[model samples]
Target: LVIDEIKGRDLRETLIAFGEHLMGAYMSPALIGVYRTVVAEANRYPTLGRTFYENGPARATGRLAEVLEAAEARGEIDADDCFRAASHFVGMIRDNLHLQVVLGLRPPPDADEARIAVLSAVDVFLNGVASHR
Candidate 1:
């Protein structure tokens, strides 16, 4: 389901889908709690960090990087640094909405808000990449 959410008919659609999915997942209470607790205890229990990386963001970011690399090969974007671009892409999605929720500065976005936010993030990222390329 998670992988499918990040797969689309095209790169643009995939970015949108991924952004939407990421926002929704990150905003979930269970996920947020896990992230908080993991970070807080990761130093004392180093394997917790390893587990989180393997099971969580690593999977998504690695997938995203692979997609970006394919897109670059296809001349779809100017991604000289596919991994960095992928990381930045996810950061763009998470920075505002996810951070707000984590900080308790704002509630999680509703479906409509999530849709709009994801759309905007995809557009901004695509535009930036287009120009950079």
Candidate 2:
């Protein structure tokens, strides 16, 4: 879903779309409840965590890695490890905001807030990985 939204876009645009998708997913109450349940039961059911990771985060990361690989081929970025880069990008998008939301310390970001967060992350990430020449 997210990969389809981000595919064929330029690096900045791709990151923006990706970030927005992540923010939407993270903000979903149903998903939050499911994640909380999964976390709370993870110790008792070890396979739950692995299952969640494989089905959710792992799939997202794999798709993002494909996007990053395409960006590298296009000379938009210079990533030696697309999968690691994809993970880093996801981490950056989540940041402290996601932690705060997950902990119930704050409400989910509004659209403007999400945009600002995503753009900031995209800029920083682009600066780090953009092709030197």
Candidate 3:
């Protein structure tokens, strides 16, 4: 479902969809708890961190990087480093909402809120990634 959401009409639409799905997925308490536990035990259990990265954020970032690289190849984006751009794209959309949810500052946003948040992040990210001729 998440991966399907990422395939959109264009790069910007794809990013917006990706951000929306990501926000939806991360809103889960179980996922948030897993993140907290993984971070807390990372030092004592290195493999835990490695496992989390391999199964979670790294996978997402890698997938997005592939898309970004394709866009770059097509001359749609001027990305010097697609992997780094992927990371920034996900981080920009996810970090603040995830933090707010984890800290109990706010509940996971509803559908309308998610739309607004994802679109806003996509706008900012698109601006940053725009080719400066």
Candidate 4:
């Protein structure tokens, strides 16, 4: 009976979990969509779109910096906070780039992390725009 119980418990190791399927479904389009959204939104900003087109990653970082600067000038948030926010946003993007390749693990270890990162980036963008406006 005891051996049977252990085998039953160990059965989980033999079976593939369901979340692997979900992340596989979501991650690809997500990476592409996020890239497009970031580019599209940055373009909406004055001179930012061209800057991004000429130099992608450098421009993305620059856009975040510009947003941070505007936020600082408005006194709505601290500079370090903006920097941290942008760092997370960048990390999330970087992680998403990696996670798409490892979708077999249940729940995809970085899926939640990536979602939060994307949200953080969007939040910073919105807050920055409001500050500048």
TM-scores for the candidates:
0.86, 0.90, 0.87, 0.34
Residue 120 Cα positional deviation in candidate 1, in Å, after optimal superposition: 1.4
lDDT of 4 by residue, 19-88 (tens): 2222343355564455556556874684666654556445444555555556567665566666565555
**Candidate 2 residue pairs that clash:** none
Positional deviation of residue 24's Cα in model 3 after best superposition, in angstroms: 1.2
Candidate 3 residues lying further than 4 Å off, grouped into runs, are: 1-8, 129-133
Candidate order by TM-score, decreasing, is 2, 3, 1, 4
Q: Which ten residues in a row have the lowest lDDT in candidate 4?
A: 10-19
Candidate 1: Cα lDDT at 17: 76
Task: Estimate candidate 3's alpha-carbon lDDT, on a 0 to 1 scale.
Answer: 0.84
lDDT by residue for model 1 over 51-116, one digit each (tens)? 998888877788889888878887889978998988888888887678778777888889998888
Per-residue lDDT of candidate 3, residues 14-87 (tens digit): 88778877787788778988988998899999999999989888898998898898889888899899999999
User: Where is model 2 more than 4 Å wrong at Cα?
Assistant: 129-133
Considering TM-score, which of the candidate structures 1 and 2 is the better prediction for this target? 2
Worst 10 residues of 2 by lDDT: 1-10
Enumerate residue pairs that collide in model 4.
none
Model 3 lDDT-worst window of ten: 1-10
Candidate 4 segments whose C-alpha is farther than 4 A from its true place: 1-54, 80-85, 102-117, 120-133
lDDT of each: 0.83, 0.85, 0.84, 0.46
